[model samples]
Target: MVTFIEKGFLYGFILGLSLGFFIVPYKEVFPMGEGVTETTYLNLVDFIIPLIRVGVITAVIGGLVGFFFYRKKIRAYNNK
Candidate 1:
C-alpha cells in the first residue's frame, strides 16, 4: 500500500509538471478564470498544481491498493 502510494505520488508529480508546463495555461485544463493575473497564474502553476496532483493521486492509488488487497484476502479466506 505504501509502495503504491509512493509510486502514485511520483506519477502525480510528473503529471503536475506536464500540466504546469502545457495544459494549465489558457485556463483550459483547470481554469482559474479571467480575473486571475499573470502573477497569480504563475503562483498557481508553482504551488496549486502539485498539491492537487499529490492529493488526487494519493487517494486514488491508496484506495485501489487497499481494495485489491482486501479483495484478495477475502478470496483467500473464502477458499479455506
Candidate 2:
C-alpha cells in the first residue's frame, strides 16, 4: 500500500495541476470587447514545464516526509 505521504502528494499534484490549468486560467478569460482581443491560454507545452516541476517537487518532498516518519517508527520499535 502507498504511504499517506505518497497518497497526499499524488492527490495534491493532481488537484494543483487541475486548478492551475483549468480554473486559474479563467482569470484572463474576459470576453473580447470592441477592438480588443481576448487573452490566450498558455500553450499546452508551456504549461507542461511548470506542471512537471510542481509534480516532481511535491513528490520528492512527500517521499522525504514519509522516509522521516518511517525512520522514526523504526527507532521507536527498536527501543521498545
Candidate 3:
C-alpha cells in the first residue's frame, strides 16, 4: 500500500516533468489573449511550478487508484 503511494509519487513527478518539457517549448504558439506581456513566457520557474503542482495532484490520485485496485484484487482473491 505504502509502496504503491511512493511509486505513484515518483511516476507522477516524472510524468509531470515530461509534460512540462513538451508544453513549455510550444507555449508561444498557444494564444494567451491580448494584454499579456513577454514576462509570461515559459521560463524555468513557470515550467517547474506546474510540474510540481501537477505531479503532486497526480500522485495523490494515482495513490488512491492503486489502493482501490489493490483492495479489489485482495477481496476477489479472498472470495475464492
| Model number with the top TM-score | 3
For model 3, residues 40-65, the per-residue Cα lDDT tens digits are: 45777766776677667766777777
Candidates sorted by TM-score, descending order?
3, 2, 1
User: How high is each candidate's TM-score?
Assistant: 0.41, 0.58, 0.63
Cα RMSD to native, each candidate?
Answer: 7.1, 4.6, 4.7
Error of 1 at 40 (Å): 13
Query: What are the lDDT figures for the candidates, one per model?
Result: 0.58, 0.65, 0.68
- Report the lDDT tens digits of candidate 2 across residue range 1-80: 24756775676576566655553342245577887777767777777777776666666666666667777887899999
lDDT of 1 at 6: 62
Task: Sort the candidates on lDDT, descending order.
Answer: 3, 2, 1
State the lDDT at 46 in candidate 2. 70
Relative to the unseen true structure, what is the Cα RMSD of model 2?
4.6
Question: Taking the candidates one at a time, how many backbone clashes does each contain?
Answer: 0, 0, 0
lDDT, candidate 3, at 60: 74
Q: Candidate 1: lDDT of 45? A: 56
Put down candidate 1 lDDT per residue, 1-80, tens digits, no spaces: 46654665566556655555554443324446897633423455566665666557655665566567766777899999
Error of 3 at 10 (Å): 2.3
Worst 10 residues of 2 by lDDT: 19-28
